[model samples]
Target: MTPASEPATATSLPIGSDADLAWVRHQVRQFAAEIGFGLVQQTKLVTAASELARNTLLHGGGGQAKIIPLISGPARGLRLSFIDTGPGISDVELAMSDGYSTEGGLGLGLSGAQRLVDELTIDTEPGRGTVVTVVAWATGVPAPRPGSR
Candidate 1:
């Protein structure tokens, strides 16, 4: 695994509906592409974002996705954090399993998302909410644009 660093830039988008999910995916795709991720890698990150965004809206009752561009020495990556304040996961292990879901989903959102990104972290509490973070690394990152995202 590559070493990590602070985000060079960041952006936050709300996850309130299907339209919001599409918007998140588009932003992620654009950023991932700009940062030098290959087509396959970009797709993986966007797919994971879509699934987590859906979870935020449908299950968590709405939230936001904090998108961050990270740098590790000369390499770079993108981190996406989906946060919500609604009911949290009761069983994290179960939630990561192959065929488990709380919302009658085909049960592939979280599990499949994990397989897509370079790093994944899910923080939750029974009563609080959930924050699902995913990071995708780039093979060759060009110089990023200056200024805030």
Candidate 2:
């Protein structure tokens, strides 16, 4: 049986810096490039991370973000995850949908993030917290599994 073709991995970065959002974005871009991600894709992914990180700070009252290198399916890649223990999103599906936003938010919304990446996953509960994850490969490939990762 052919199990799968996973590739090499680099170190992951866990972040929590309210005043260092730009630095965080820079790190993501540089690391994504190191992981073989192209320039345009790197911009999208980094921008997505920036949005999520900003939400964590502005909406969630600050939290944590992590950049994880993903080595799977014969391609080099990286994963960015933003998590917060603050008041969770009330409506996940609605929030993820385009043109949906609460009164105070920027209204650019999570849809942009979803559009920027190859794969995206989100989990949230009203009072628990929110976790947003994005995965992208070196090439602009579609997400291999809908729910596996």
Candidate 3:
């Protein structure tokens, strides 16, 4: 099915509070499970969402994220979109490279997100905004993989 055909659940929030981020993270975990993603994939997706939320707060001057659920028959998945109005990435190629971080800390956000999911897409321009989308799926289940207790 076309990516747009996937059923989606989206929430938009300002980036001024930690509480907002936490809530979004929780929702992401719940949504991932509903979409039938594996545990490893769910963890990775949640982490990626965390990174995007932080980026919106710190870098994008606050933005929004749209989480979409992709059900590909026997393989269920999720599509995450993080969009920000802040200055976009000047060098996406460099940013994706390992060990490259614009922030003072290790820059594992984008790169690590890319590694965790099955598909990754990015659109950004200097002065405009940034949009990062990631998709991941369950490997062997009609339903979501069991979560770790």
* Best-matching candidate per lDDT: 1
Candidate 2, poorest ten consecutive residues by summed lDDT:
1-10
Ranking by lDDT: 1, 3, 2
Q: Per-candidate RMSD vs. true structure?
A: 4.7, 4.3, 5.6
lDDT for residue 141 in candidate 1, whole number 0-100: 53
Off by over 4 Å in 2: 1-18, 103-106, 140-149
Model 2 C-alpha lDDT per residue in residues 1-149, reported as the tens digit of each score:
12123434434444456556787798899888887787898899888988888877766767777777765554567777788887899978778777776657657658888888767888888788888877777786443443333
TM-score of 3: 0.82
lDDT-better candidate, 1 vs 2: 1
Can you tell me which runs of candidate 3 are displaced by over 4 Å? 1-5, 142-149
Number of the top candidate by TM-score? 1
140 Cα displacement, candidate 3 (Å): 1.8
Clash totals for all candidate models: 0, 0, 1
Candidate 3 per-residue lDDT, tens place, 11-122, comes to 5555566887897788889988776666777788888888877877777777777777665446677777878888998999998887887778688877887887767888
Q: What is the C-alpha lDDT of each candidate?
A: 0.87, 0.73, 0.74
> Runs in model 1 with CA error above 4 Å?
1-3, 140-149
lDDT of 3 at 108: 82
